[model samples]
Target chain A: MSFDVDIEVRRGDRTISCAFKSPRGITVLFGPSGAGKTSVLEALAGIVKPERGHIAVAGRTLFDADQGIDLAPEKRGCGYVFQDSRLFPHRSVRANLLYGWRLQPAERRLIAPELAIGFLGIGHLLDRMPRSLSGGEAQRVAIGRALLSGPQFILMDEPLASLDASRRAEILTLIERIRDELGLPIAYVSHERGEVDRLADTIVPIGLPD
Target chain B: MILSEVEWQIVALSLKVSAVAIFGALPISFVLAWVLARKHFAGKVLLDALVHLPLVVPPVVTGWLLLIVFGNNGPAGRWLEQTFGLQFMFRWTGAALAAAIMALPLMVRAMRLSIEAVDRKLEIAARTLGAGPWRTFFEITLPLAFPGVLAGMVLGFARSIGEFGATITFVSNIPGETRTLPLAIYAALQMPGNEADATRLAVVSVVLSLLALIVSETLARRSMRERGGHVL
Candidate 1:
């Protein structure tokens, strides 16, 4: 599915604007810590309402402030992996992964839960509680949960920030596999240059403001 | 060794009043806790103060206030009595209302802490995953706050079971009707040479309070474990 964004949002004292479209593959929002990368991703996902401009995924208008058509986050058909994983600590990994699927319309595509469990290499973690998962494991489960949502676009904000170097390497490779195999349009937010170089297909640098 | 018929009646009546008070206040307390923890509105401080009014006010004053608004001739009382054919004046219902008011502050405090403790990011994630506002509240927020809700209920139950001053003031000490454990003990202590009866009732109250505390703690721990959260 195609993903397009032309949005301006206020970040603290700054007014940041961005416009881009990705037909397929990963589009990395590469920048420094305070460079408004997460804000852009949040706006696209409908988590943060844009000050102006519009967002459309697969030609479906998700937001247009002028038109007064701002779809709620749930109806945007976007998957988001929060910086902290945000796994439902009360649910098992399997349950967390199945949560989004449970909310889908009955006529939606029937993607098996096992595919996500296997894709993220979290088969063994299905019954494990979120508290039992290590940082890397939790991140993997977060990715799996997002994927199981049948999203047209996936937004991940520093999904590997909590991991060690070796763990980051493992998750990075897995992300590349998800990109090549699933071909889902992905927007990744990160301050680390090394991660961007390793995983990003289209590096959308957070350019200096005028 | 055996509870006399009068003692049994008093015990049953106290339990019934406490149960009704706790059950009645639960939903309103939960909504108030969410509002206090998450929302900011005009006169929020005033609303917060009103919720904790029972805590700082003398129980006698609280009872007097309840009587003013909820007594038979009062506005709310008149409306209720006219529209619903219900009465709260100097009855067991009045005792339950008094207990609920006395226990409300503690319930709100416990629940507010729990609701605040929830990681808001999780709710955001749920939103992105296609759960609407009410659905996210029930599925995610409520389950995560289960431990806190349980604490609030236990605190309310304990507070209600021991409600005295407000209950007496609102409903008076009608044996087997408005008389709860605390009121019963107070009544016994005032009568001529009824020290033994007072002590027995006081021991029962203590035992009941201790049991509720233990149960609350146990359930809190269990909820934490079930959710894979670390006990703090």
Candidate 2:
């Protein structure tokens, strides 16, 4: 029900290191741009391997340098919603959502596609292509796609950065509803403090490395 | 319309040989293109250069190399002749093999460029959604790069149809067997008072090549549009 991370990552000249435990709630990593906030989530999601340290979600060790254990992103079972919503342009909305769900083991499938579609209010968009969707609609689909993958925890990296103010507000409300209704742990990365205040159950401040 | 019955037979044989060559080379070309596009390993440069050698070398040289490696006296040719009873020298199959070898570089180049153009981010996204490497490639990379694949296939087909030097050098100009359109055209030009037959074959070649180009262009544009990409 919690994620524990202690890792150090080096990107060229800069080094990023942090250790924190996120309980069963929305934990927001608030920082300025270029503070490596997204990198932290990427490390947790097994997209970027850490230079050193360990990551565990729900007591499962995803990465441990001492043990020489580093699970692939697919095996880590952590859902990631990128800022750009990286939906497959060649696939319809339903196909994109089912891309992960179809691969999940029957016993491990915690969230059904229907439930995800219902939760995200994207049922009507099932047949449409990702390119035709609005920014907000695409992001919602991205969120639903993540949820349907049966992830142990969700990592969202500035998921609403590309949306307008109105769409942003609408998505924020949807996120709140998801957190309250589904009770899924989320590690949200954002530079905006207002968003952290509204959604974060625990806030981890990130800043430029000394 | 000016083509005689024998000339039409040559045309049909040419089409059949080139079609076989294209389809035969496609799967191998795709695998090679993917390796060239996505993988980095020792000897990669050497492998790439080898794959592209037919493009820069003289077609006669390529044909000579094929003859050296796949001729009746060669190990592979001997083994195939003994084990499989398949001979490539002076055969229609030899013509197809020559055409495929000559056209492979174009197919690989087109497929590699297309594969490279696919967004890596989409692949990473697929991985996060629990798709294994094979699944990601088939479901995401292949579909996204399909337009380029089609373009490559057309280019290969066009090249196979026009293959001359390698085919003639490897298979020799055996009428009704190894003599394709280009060889037939050459044969007509060599005989006295057969200039009209050669001109007819030339026109047919030009029209077929033009049709292939148009079809490739249309397919490429349609693929781009289907993926919501702006047509350039």
Candidate 3:
């Protein structure tokens, strides 16, 4: 599914103006710390209300200022994985993965818990609590939690930022396996060119003057 | 026989009063905690102060305020009497109301801490997971705040069990009507040769407070353990 986003957002004193309408694939948003790449993902997911412009995902109007429409993040069906995994500390790994499925209106949750557990290679860790997992393990679980919801497009905000270099290398392969093998559309945020070059089907470079 | 009867009476009365107080204030505490922890409206500090008024204000003053709002011929009191054949002044219900008011601050404080501690990212994750605002609260925010909610309940229960000043002012120490444990203890102490009864009741109060505190601490520790393990 193709998506379109044309918006301008202000982060502190800096203003970011993005105008892009790309065909659906793995679109990597490359930028430095202050380049407002995460801001773009947030805008798409209906987290940060934009100052101006509209976002249309798969022909559906997710945000339109002139039309007085701004869908809530949940309703937009855009999954987001934070830099820090942000797993529910109160829940076990199984519970965290099943949280989204349980919230689904019975019929909407197409993926079963066993399927999700297998896909994330976390079947062995299902009964384990989030606290017991390694950083890479937690991110893998976080990804499983997000994918279980069966979102239209996934937004990953520097998912590997918290891991060690070796861990990053390992998780990068996992992310690619999820994207390429699963055939899921992704909007990945990263400052590392190597990660972008390896996984990205289309690059939307940010941070530099444009 | 008389001492055992009085002990049972105090136990039953204290339990009843605390239950009613907790039931009355829990929903209000949830809403107020969310507003205080999440919302950024104008005069938020004032709203927070108003919710926590009971903590700073004397229980006697809280009792007096309850009397003013729920006494005979008072607006809420008159409306309730007319609409539901209810009477708060000089009644058990009034003692409950007083206890609830007294305990509200503790409950709100506990709930606010829990709500504030919820990861904003998790809530955002739930939203993207196709859970709406209300769904997100029940499925994500509330569960994540479970440890806090339980702690709040214990705080409210402890506060309510010991409530005396407000109970005395609003409902008085009517035996078997509104004479909760604290009230019973106070009446026992005032009478000639009832020191033993007062002491027994005081010990019971201590036991209950200790139990509540222990449970609260356990829950707090479990929550910390869960979150701490997740951290890098």
By TM-score, the best candidate is 1
TM-score of every candidate relative to the true structure: 0.96, 0.94, 0.91
**Model 1 RMSD, rounded to 1 decimal:** 1.8
Q: Comparing candidate 1 with candidate 3, which one achieves the higher DockQ? A: 1
Alpha-carbon RMSD of each model: 1.8, 2.1, 3.0
Candidate 3's residue-wise lDDT over A1-210, tens digit each? 456888988777777888777686778888888889988989999988889999988788999988999999878877678888878777789888877767667565546778767777789998888888999889989988887776767789999988998988877887887676656678899999888898788888887555
DockQ-based class of model 1: high
- lDDT string, candidate 3, B126-169, tens digits: 78877888888887788778778788989999999999998999
lDDT of 1 by residue, B1-232 (tens): 5667888788889889999999999999999999999999999999899999999999999898889999998999999999999888878999999999999999999999999988888899999999999999999988888889889999999999989989888889998779889999898988889998888788888988999999999988888878854322
Candidate 2 or 1, higher DockQ? 1
Residue-wise C-alpha lDDT for candidate 1, range A164-209, written one tens digit per residue: 9999889889888878887777888988888878877778888657
Off by over 4 Å in 3: A102-116, A208-210, B222-232
Q: Please, what are the lDDT tens digits per residue for candidate 2 over residues B1-232? A: 7778988899899999999999999999999999999999999999999999999999999888889888999888889899999999999999999999989999999999988988999999999999888888888888888888888899999999999999999999999999998999899999999888889999999999999999999988877767853221
- Best-performing candidate as measured by DockQ: 1
Q: Extract clashing residue pairs from model 1.
A: none
How far is A39's C-alpha from truth in model 3 (Å)? Answer: 0.4
lDDT of 2 by residue, A16-83 (tens): 88788878789899989999998899898888889999998878999999999999999988789999
